[model samples]
Target: MKERFRLWSRAQDASPPRIAAAKAPRAAAISSASRRPALPRGVRIYAVGDIHGCVDALDALLIRIANDVKSSPIRNWRIVTLGDYLDRGPSSREVVERLIKLNELNCLIALKGNHDVWLDTFIANPETFREWEPWGASATLVSYGLDLVSLGAPDRCAALAAEFARVLPREHADFLRNLRNHYVCGDYLFVHAGLRPRVALRDQKEADLIGIRQDFLRHNGAFEKFVIHGHTPVEAPDVHKHRINIDTGAYATNRLTCLVLEGAARRFLFSDTPLPD
Candidate 1:
């Protein structure tokens, strides 16, 4: 199984097209075979990396997961999303709605990623809007639901901005306001980005969790229980000896990855599937 997984991951890394094809079939298979049993218990921590506005993908993944747990013999099911829940791709609005709904229904812990920090900054300081490229000012518009192009006149920018503010949903703002930075399961710490090897999980800054890539992944994580994260979409889930990365770059590509760690046996069940668009 290990060898087969390695081969699959490597084939995915072989090319961007290959990665998509690889992920799509693997996910499709899981959906077809997964039977709906009762929701499993016992702390099976299922983690997703970065979902950039892929609502359909997320929906499909969740349904399959539901089917999987129902068929399994367990007591509980828990999900940890590594952030990047908003921006890019399509359906940012729907994505937030679904996540909030998930939290309401089950045991879910959503962490903040760099994209989320950008979203926060966009909300707090709309002036910083011009800084980013295509995605710049996106969150501001999303929060307000006003088309920047439709502003039409320079004079309306401020008025449009205020209108946008008024239209903003209170709960939507509250959700972003309340998003947590990290999550821990058993011996492992799940972060959006990563932590400095020397720094304790509690000591890591908010910025560190949303951003920070290489210095963390490149280093021999050697942390306790392994740092499971999303943020940097890996070829597959980077199931190394120390860390696991399940972000399959859903926004850019069409694939979403999930890391399913069986609660009882402590074994890993990797399932990748398409977002139900």
Candidate 2:
């Protein structure tokens, strides 16, 4: 079945002609000979976008990635997940378990998303459940065999927190505690959300790294690195001179995207196969 899946490259003509014109000024303004963003020679990075607990999609995508590597081997490769591995889907528990195992293999670089951080906050202060509930917290709770109706009582914040902490596996807690805010590779910065304009990458705040939207999205200026991020859902992958957003709302749309960067080429692999609900 993995053999059937193929790497999908963005057609050169797929992008509107205006996009090049829009980006030309920024590239020229940055540097007269600014070359296309690229990774180190012979290195390949497969960065997966917001999982949102879609384990089936994650599993399928991993298989596709494995097949790609087997067919075309590279010496130095990395699989970086752009976070949101929990919430919004039916398999949050399974998702964490899979990620933990993958991390142990030393090939996975997991970045933290706002939802993943919220899970930690929710575990510590269940009062935050109110904030998370609207963003698919109940699905995660249910995945862990917790009854939302019982946990959702008006005054059960402490009780809910205690119950959650007790049920959460130790490795899972460790995984959440260890998630990185961002990762850099060659000329690309992989972050959960877009970066704040004009801020140095080293000084970016955690909150903005996993949550900020409009300010970063609206900024037309260039940054120190070409950013590849998730967090905001778009109908399709949004690629520009500055950043690439690969979050296609996997929890709802079932289209889990993985952006592939090898040298100067960019392509995509997707796990859009429907699974049983």
Q: How large is the C-alpha RMSD of every model relative to the true structure?
A: 10.1, 8.1
Candidate 1 structure quality by residue, lDDT tens digits, 1-277? 1221231332233322222454432221111113321113466777776778776666656655665576574565677888888777666777777777667665678887776655445445555455542552454355347666676423344455465567767776677777888776665678888877787766778887778888888886366446778878765556555666778877666677777776323333333442233
Misplaced by over 4 Å in model 1 are 1-20, 23-41, 136-144, 152-161, 264-277
Candidates' lDDT values, in order?
0.62, 0.80
TM-score leader: 2
Q: In angstroms, give how far residue 277 of model 2 lies from its true place.
A: 25
Q: What is the alpha-carbon lDDT for the whole of candidate 2?
A: 0.80
Model 1 TM-score relative to the real fold? 0.76
Error of 2 at 71 (Å): 0.7
Overlapping backbone residue pairs in candidate 1 total 15
